[model samples]
Target: MKWFFKIVVLSILLQSFQCTDTDDNSGAIISAQLETKKQEIQNYINSFSCSESVGCGFIAFGSKPCGGPRSYLLFSNSVDLTKLQAMVKTYNDMDELYNVQTNAVSDCMFVAPPTEVKCMNGICTIIK
Candidate 1:
């Protein structure tokens, strides 16, 4: 009888733990968010025109348009404005500043302490 009670108690404890919601530790949710961000940046880069010398940069795009023509600050380093302008002209892309703003940051890190960015369509706005 004692062994039966012990088993029952252990089962109940296990069930309770299984039902608990620990979103902070959810790997799938985090992975999906990361993937979505990656797609947004990829699309933005693909559409942007920078000469072969300009290389690439990271950005946070929003899910919707950000009003009319405006300058965007990218989270990237070693960005050449001249090259970016050249690419924009070649690709007819919008004018956006990369790593030029005072509050610039990168979204390329996948390590602990995830980054939060608001991206819509091909426009990205950093949320610091």
Candidate 2:
């Protein structure tokens, strides 16, 4: 999943570098299109999971926490354009449900939901 996205981005970046030798609007247009595609891919991914630790906070007492609620996703099988995906995430400290569509797929994809944050219960340390 992640590899596919990396390949796409890497290819775009490589193309950008390769374009410098030539003088034309082609490079700019290509980069812009590729970047837009990347953004679309990212938006589609966010519907599944958090790209990073988000809505971060912990359940603790007096600055010492025991546990915390983290963003999680239960993505369905591969996307079907004919259907919509039920996506959930924490918004304003509440669970927000969305029926968003899967727009695109990427080779270098990073599925969501990171582990416990670097800090646990107000204590900063390695999560591992």
Candidate 3:
């Protein structure tokens, strides 16, 4: 009876450790996916070029755990605006979901939007 009790307790402990490891692995996977999505959005933005400040624009990107966008991305009008917006929306949605799943915490500070976007030295950039 004593040996049986010990084996049962050990089994329960091992199962608990395995469950914890699985949770950690899943969280890491989600984080990696978020980074990949962010890179895709950035690569798409960088593929376009700008010649004039008037042609530069900014879009809100990423989701803060507390609420609102984490920051803005500057882009040129030369890119496909519709496609870019859709990609950004998808990224934002993923980020929001990740935050909720991970119980992510932040300072909750409001990130101010850029006052202006400009084409500076052939690159679209925020002027704030």
Candidate 4:
């Protein structure tokens, strides 16, 4: 009887550990996906030509036209405008940012944790 109890306890413990591992992996995947999306957004902003002179950035998520013209959403720790511009060069196919943003707004409806950039119709908000 004691042996049976020990076996059951060990099984429960193993199952619990497995569940925790799965959760950790899932969290990592989600974070990675978000970061990739954020970088893509930054690329779109950098590609555009802001008229006049200004020091501002934008992030957009979701499918609504709520935020200003140039707005974006990020899921990372920092919101460095210069870093965002530099990151845009890493992508081989920048056009994909449109489809990705569209899907993110219409399908995933993901929002950046820090900024208020919303995506709508495959275009992130752009401000002058």
Candidate 5:
């Protein structure tokens, strides 16, 4: 009876450890998904090109743990603005959720928005 009780307790302890491991794995999975989403946004932005005539614009991207965007993205106005905005929203939402879930910390420094955006050479550039 003593041996059986010890064995049961050990099994419970092992199960608890396994549960924590699963939680850690979930956090890693979320991080990976966030990175993938970020890359997707970048790829979409890259698909469009800007020239002096094409025009360029900037949009805030990603949510910080403390609030506000992590950074801004520059893109050509020739792209599908509606689709791009939707994708950014999705990515931001996921980023916010990931921050909350992982208890992510940030410097909480204010990121200034661009003073101007223009097409420099063949690419859209943000002039700080």
Candidate 6:
């Protein structure tokens, strides 16, 4: 009887530990997703065109305006509206839960949470 009780307790403890491990992994996965999103925003910004006055512009570093959060989506002066629409759709599909804001500067793209769109102006430096 003693041995059996010990075995059962051990099994329960093991199960609890396993559950904690699973939760840890889920957190890590979420972090990775956010990192990937940041990288995508960086790539888009690096190619933004500052020459065009009408298109998107980058905001300087250390200055992020609020709106949820914001992401810049810059493009050339001759951005294809249809293509931009498609890209927006694709991004929305990636994470259905969080709202995505896309700002299009001249040849650049800044992507962030919807609250931070205003910061996506003339600062075209790549965020490291």
Task: Work out the TM-score per prediction.
Answer: 0.23, 0.20, 0.75, 0.24, 0.77, 0.32
What are the per-residue Cα lDDT tens digits for candidate 4 across 1-128? 99999999999999887844334333222335546865676565546543223233443332222322222343222345566545543331232343344443333333444333333333443322
The residue ranges of model 2 lying beyond 4 angstroms of the native Cα positions read 1-29, 50-128
What is the per-residue lDDT of model 5 for residues 9-127, given as tens digits with 9 covering 90 to 100? 99999988784433444434387888898899899889888989889998999999999999999999999999999999998998998888789999999998899999998799888
Off by over 4 Å in 6: 1-29, 57-75, 78-84, 98-128
After best superposition, candidate 1 residue 118: deviation in angstroms? 29
Error of 5 at 62 (Å): 0.6
- lDDT by residue (tens digit), candidate 3, 1-128: 99999999999999887844334444342878889989998999888889874488888899999999998888888889999999999889989988888899998999898897788888987877
Off by over 4 Å in 4: 1-29, 53-128
lDDT, candidates in the order shown? 0.41, 0.33, 0.86, 0.43, 0.89, 0.42
By summed lDDT, the worst window of 10 consecutive residues in model 5 runs over: 20-29
Please provide, for model 1 over 1-128, each residue's C-alpha lDDT reduced to its tens digit, 9 standing for 90 to 100: 99999999999999888866655543222334534544554454556544334433443232112222222335323345465444434221221222222233444433222144444344444455
The TM-score that candidate 1 achieves is 0.23
How well does candidate 2 score on lDDT at residue 67?
Answer: 24
* TM value for model 3: 0.75
**Model 6: per-residue lDDT, tens digit, 1-119?**
99999999999999887844334333222435645765664565455444435444322221122322234454443344464555444444443333232321232245442222222
Better of 3 and 6 by TM-score: 3
Model 6 lowest lDDT segment of ten: 60-69
Local distance difference test, candidate 5: 0.89
Best by lDDT: 5
Please identify which of the two predictions, 2 or 3, would achieve the higher TM-score against the true structure.
3
